[model samples]
Target: MVEIRGGAATSLDDMVFEFLEYGEESSPESSFSSGDGCYDDDRDEERSFDVEESKAFWDEQMKLLQGTFYRTNSVESKIRQATKEVLKDAAYSSQCGCGRLRVEAGGGCRSCLRREVCNRLMNLGYDCAICKSKWRSSSSIPSGEHTYLEVVHRSNEKRGELRVVIELNFRAEFEMARASEEYNRLIGNLPEIFVGKTERLRGLIKILCSAAKRCMKEKNMHLGPWRKHKYMQAKWLGTCERSAPAPLPVGNAARPAKSKASMLTFDLSEAIPIPGLRRTAVEVGVI
Candidate 1:
């Protein structure tokens, strides 16, 4: 009969004979020959190597994916923060003394008076008051003083280039001009002809807004070497339907075409500045 040594059958042939002869021998121990053991060792070593390689590759991939995700999140956060700050500054700059005065004909601050004049001008179809106003200043308003306008840039992986968006905020520079004693004295003399300080402030803001829009249009048109990739571009997508030519009436009778109400879009990427003012200090973020 075969005997188990160290919990293993010493010989496979002996173990089988012993089981057949005794008819009730104990179960044989699981053991391999030296050659078979060496073969298995090689296989296990190879499998272990493969597992390690797979683990390392997957770890690297995970790190890369995580890095990309975090970077995108970081960029978005910065854009949002910058946008909030710019909007706040713009709103603050746009604030005027109009709200402090009661709305009365010939009885309020110049700021209030301007709004009334603007309404009258709008009704009169003189939308280009900034260009035509007698009180419009000729001096170039230096930026970064009463206004903070900037362009923030982020890399577009898909486009393989930088994408730019603008942010603009301006304070009323004409406040002092309106509050000056000379201006007050002049208004007193020609109250009917002179627009208030508020109107003057509005005109300046309009000029700046116009300049900003022009800058954006120019940038989009040029796109600076990345135009081929369509990487940096700006557009003004209004919320009004495109005006189409009206069809001629079949008979002499015809209905008047409904006027399309256009709304301005406040998208920084497609910001439209008021048409004529030139901005001097436009900050751009580093990539």
Candidate 2:
């Protein structure tokens, strides 16, 4: 005979069997008298439901947080990449004639004079001092029939850096050539004294400056605002500014001149119609 003790622990199988037996043998009125079991069952179900809801809510929150983090990271990365690419290899070059005149009366051949002027202009950081003065005087500058200046942009890519060169077309040279007598006289004179004698050189200078200004405007239009945003975001994220190397003090004799990316600023309000020339003037100083 199997003996069962009162108030003893029961196995799952035993509990199931006892529950079934009680349900069958006990009267409904008697079962109702002990309401604690029903209440406990309801409480357990409520607890399970609450736990499930809390877990689901936390899971959703985590997903949203992760998504936001990823999106921010993606935008920052893109901006940084673009900024680096735009700044990496930016340069400009011009093929404007030197304001020096060459003629038989000057005892110099046109080809020799042209070469000398070009070489001198290149040495002077590709600036014609004479041209700058002319640009200041002119209301309207001439355009070139052929492109005279080139602006280069090299962008980083997986395959390689993509290079883009913009050639500026101006009408200055063509117009000067059309006025043959004045053009010939202007070229034959020495550049030092020739500045006051000719409008051709001035017109050419104005055109060159205009071309340079346009290039800078285009560059700023494309990248300036985007780069600013990237810089701000980097500053906020604590990824760049704090960790960046300190700038060398101006008075530190031991510090080497560090080359930085050139930032072009264009001031539309200037005596010369060409904007962004102040910085250029500094680089390509007057003759």
The reply for model 2, stretches above 4 Å from the true place, is 1-39, 72-75, 80-287
Q: State model 2's lDDT.
A: 0.26
**Model 2: clashing residue pairs?**
101-187, 102-187, 143-170, 143-171, 143-172, 144-170, 144-171, 144-172
Estimate the TM-score for candidate 2. Answer: 0.17
**Residues 189-243 of candidate 2: C-alpha lDDT, one tens digit per residue:** 2111111111222333433333223333323333222123222222111111111
lDDT, model 2, position 5: 16
Question: Which whole-number lDDT from 0 to 100 does residue 122 have in model 1?
Answer: 35
